[model samples]
Target: MERNAIILAAGKSDKFAPFTYEKPKGLFCVKGDVLIERQIEQLQEAGVMDIYVVVGYMKEKFFYLEQKYGVKLLVNNQFGKKGNLYSLYVARNYLKNTYICCADHYFPANPYLNDNPENLSYRACTYLSGKFREFAIDYSDAKVITGFNVGGRDGMAMVGHAYMNEGFSSVFRQFLENEINDFGVSDLFWEEFYAGHQRSLTFYMKEYQAGEIYEFENIDDLREFDSEFLMNVDSDIITNICNTLGCVPNDITDINAINAGLTNVSFSFQCGGEKYVYRHPGGTSGNLIDRTTELFAQEKAGKLGIDESVINMDLSGWKISHYIHNARNCNLEESDEQLETIMDYLHRIHSVDVASEKNVKVFDNVAEANKLMEMASMIKGNLKREFAVLIEKIDILYDAVRADAKRLGYGLVLCHNDVYEPNFIYDSEGKVYLVDWEYAGMNYAANDVGSIICRYDFADCQIERYFRAYIGHELTDDERRFYYAYIPISAYYFFCWGLYKGSIGENDGFFFLSSYRNMIRFIDVALESYGIVI
Candidate 1:
């Protein structure tokens, strides 16, 4: 059989942050040497030099290894969504007589040889005192692998390294190719597959002495093995995580990356036996959001008991908040009861007595978007003419709403300018709280109301329900006209905001068009029914 090796480096290593934020865990430098390079050098010393590395998280960074160390690179495009089982599946063809390796594993010396006593393949493990809840191995007296457990008292803990002969690889590959297509089991570890098929396979347990192998489950492990990473890991996220929770890096575990956030990069971790979220700003957030005002709004909301998930938020725009398990966003269009709950929170937010220079003037934003579109060189041709016409229509509606605000004594209150489904976190106990105060400022309370109406795409008939549910009573004709006019103006501002985001190279054309088309219909309604034309 031909000697070969497959190294799995495609995992994002959420626990390895904030180093993995810049590069994958395999690229981390330990003792002045790249982690993956050391593993490759050790494999070469064992005469298994034909190494194939499957990379996904930071695949480009591993490209230079092809020329430097004569290793072949295989790409796993689903690395972010899938686990190491998929990484190994990507290299399924090269499993014969192969030493399966992990990129983050640190071996003190070469563990392979050119010749062995027999053709038997093995699963390597290290004995532990039974404290950590890691995968444990169970074997018979002849050392044939029999079964596995999640945690065992003083038993061998399963390590990543393993070997497979021609026969072993042929049988395992058949199982892999069959089960991988099932999306339900796509996230399973390769050992899980082995656990399922242990009865049909023959394998031996190769136990290693203590201090011979290193998995570096956390930063403290890597720092202990190689003293370079000392008192602090070089990660601002970790620094902030430690500072906010008053705990060391090791105290933070179960770190899973929450990649679904719209304008932030976040990870959820458990510290001091409680789950919390750490959000680092992303996209155009640094330039678009005023962190100072956001800090103040959050503090104000905290005191008002509207939202208290905020643990700490720094000037650098990184934030830590307690995670609400099984929480869902507030979608009023779906549930009228949810609408009442969210509006109560909105009403409380609008009633706050605070002073801030931050102000939201919708027409002013439309004017600014006009300037940004021309400056980014995006305005051109028929699109420019259409935008000009839209602005003209918005001007009339803007004047109409301004007249209503002045004559009716409608004053500005603290408002959450950005109100969408995802911005509200509702827990299982029927408790809901608003999030993302970056856009909150002194604005008309209807600005918040219009946000709910505009985002949910409420129909003409449904406006009355939202209006009555918000004001807690049947509306007067003047109040009805005042609120109806602001919804289209809100839609126009959203359209302009989308245009501005697109000019900066965000994929927001759908947003711009949806709001623009919606605004055009409502703008005409306001002009005929609500506009004073003064």
Candidate 2:
């Protein structure tokens, strides 16, 4: 008795668009091997001698399988018009004690389909499942499938592979024949016969632990399960990561997603009882961030006992850092004590030597706004006109601040140019730390203070209190004027930066518009307070 296998690859698989238009879903590859090809290789490894593939859309593409892998092809012309049961019905004559599966599904290990080639039929099920929108399985004490439904809350989900003996295959084929000929149910699914006609058929169950089975229903589904699937399509990144860690890929126990920023992706994984965080900078981050500058700033901050420790970095800006356990973002509204602690860290950071070559000047927004102006000039629409008007208002604010800065002569310090509430982290021991120093550079101390105050929407008294805490003395009339002057300047900085990001398509349109609105609002407040009219 020869071990036989059947692969169902007839459906159009329209859910996976444009790519499916070129070839059938089975030809899609995971890791390196094509989906159906991997299945065929595994079947062959399990001693399957006779292999059959039901091909429909792009049937000619599968013809090479006959020569390459000794696969027999059964073409279903109505594959585009009917469901999978119709495809199975076309191959009813070949139904016997054989292993059956879909071509698009992948199994991590050989399922050993020929293990028990006796006349017993069984379906493979997985205990680890999430958000399964299709079918679910329910099994009884004898390991027999008792019930199946769509919205099943249990863990058992089909792995899209089953072993069927002659008795089960004959009954299934007869039911499919009746549906197609007597009931004219051309769109019926083969699983529906097992699920609906449960009283007549008993499918013995074989359960696999999670992560063993992966079914790529569509491109989106494929991406969600493995976001890094395409990054290391040939598994090169995993190999590189293994080399870097001096461990096998399997030794790294878990990889969990970390929601950090809009442009980049981060994940936390554990290996050898130690956890680490890995961040892959997104493509657009290169447009908005200078990784060299960031690396330098973070190193300097780490030396000053401020930032997280960088364990390792790859050439492609993939960073592996020591994970900070039990840490949460600081809430400024927590108390005055927390505010004082954060202020102390900021002052120390300002006291450190700045390695960044960039500077924040009062007239910096003028140059930034000009960049926006130059970009807006090329557009041939009303958008250009609106941006032109915004530039006019920006010019007035820039001139006002430049004149004040020249008169007051504010001092410069190493500043975290992008200060926000979320950047401050508080650990379990009440130690406050700062993260994300991409925009750190030598800038006016007032710019950091004003940026923080404005971002937190601080009241005038709160602003004065914060300044007093940092300065450790009363602000003279000139110093007060200098501090107030940077409020609108910092707002314009964010506004111009946001516009710059939008011009280069670095972020979404809503973020760009919000930045413009903030710039205008701060300009108005500064003009009204400083008695400068634009």
Candidate 3:
């Protein structure tokens, strides 16, 4: 007797799209093999002589399979119009003690289908069985019972793929007839016939253990699936990431410097005779992976003339840029033009047209001020009185700033939120690179500009000249007012962020708090220098 198999590949996968837009669910590949092909290969390994495939959506793609593998093809005319049960019904005529299963699931194929005992009519169900879901046999007669959801369990009577015997076919035909009579019944016809029936002999098989199984359900899942492994590395992506900083993987002498950036963690490795940077995200707060994907999409869009090169992003995840060797440090005596380049780069990034949905407000001055006051109220240290007075002054200043902002109808742009000299990297060729984009979003542009200007001490003549050059134009009275106002507001925002970080016990929380305290002191000094009361 020849063994045969029928593959169910007709379901309309509505949930898996975009990723599945061009391919059928049956053709969805893991590693390299398509699901249906894997199923076919398994059946062949099981020594099944003939294989029948029920193809539906994008069935044309699988037409070559019959010629390539010499398998039989059964088409379901109502493929997309009907469900799996209908597809099964259309292939009923081809059933000859055949092994029927879904194409989507991964299972092994071995042990010729004809090798199973002819006396047994049912195979055991593995998933939903027993207390521990373990296979146990009755000692007296070596019969299986009590554990089977239907009735029999271990040797009570075993069934495998051999059930396609003439008697079983008659039972199956009767099952289909019963389903046809119950026209209003919404349940799958096969479930009613096979699930609770006692006559169906059942046997247990070991669990299929190979690769992990994951059911893709949504766009997020698709994104996750794509990111789970590297994409086509043979593309220009690896080269682009290497050229970003004028250095290759070999140039990373001090691995510590390479790992300093908080956005991503990087490892050096060689692939296909070339070195590469393999970086993973540092998680959600600063989602490096998501940012890399967005940057890659934007770059592709820009190349197609669909968008502007606002961020100057390179390839995705592992970006390669011309690494600047022997980069010059920005000293107090640095030329005005050097400072201008840094400020311009920062301005370009802060003014990019980020989508409104991604434009999240990370910090609000009023709310931050209130949080600081609350923190002050909770303090039991020696600086309690000083903190109390400072909170009161901060509240008054916050209210004044809010009122002024409302009166002026000022709108926000993307601000770095954390702008300091260290975050700005200057190459030896005079190009500037902004490192961290974690706190980047829509906010007052003055907040970033003010933070940069205030944090760096420019008491020297050349430094002050550099500062003036950085802005390109003299600050207007209104702009100056906002800049000065932002100093304290930004300080309070940092202070609150520090307190939150401290509450969560994040790494170096005290360091952030100390930095916030320094910023506060700087704000007070700026106010005194301008002869303004807090």
Give the Cα lDDT of each candidate.
Answer: 0.77, 0.69, 0.50
The TM-score leader among the candidates is 1
Which is the winner by lDDT between candidate 2 and candidate 3?
Answer: 2
TM-score of each: 0.62, 0.58, 0.40
Residues 1-534, candidate 3: write the lDDT tens digits: 566777777665755432232456667654455667876886787677588888887778789888888888888766644556666677777666677656665434443444565534434333323333223333223333324333343332222222355566556656665674355332343433444443553423322222233334433443355442123212233344445544443333211113323344444444334343334333223421235434533453334332231334533343332333454455434455546655665566555555644424444554644654455345423333546666566566656655666676766655555666565556555555555454554566667765554444434353335445545667666545555666566666556555544443344233355445545655564455345575
* TM-score of model 2 vs. true structure: 0.58
Arranged by TM-score with the best first, the candidates are 1, 2, 3
Deviation from native of the Cα of residue 184 in model 1, angstroms: 3.4
| Backbone clashes counted, model 1 | 0
Flag the better candidate by lDDT, 1 or 2.
1
Q: How many angstroms is residue 390 displaced in model 1 relative to the true structure, after the best TM-score fit?
A: 18
Full-model lDDT, candidate 2: 0.69
Worst 10 residues of 3 by lDDT: 251-260
Q: Tell me how many residue pairs clash in candidate 3.
A: 28
- What are the per-residue Cα lDDT tens digits for candidate 2 across 1-534? 665888999876756543453467788766767889999999999888688899988889899999999989999888866778777888888889888889988888887754764557988887644566656888899889988876455478777688888888888777776667645377767787567678877798887777777877665577677564445344444555566778765565456667536456676778788888777776456644556656666776777777755666654566777778898888766567777776777778777654444533222435544554455445423443666655565566667666776776744566676666677877778777777766665666777776666554555677788778667789986667666656666665565555555555455333344445455556666665567665
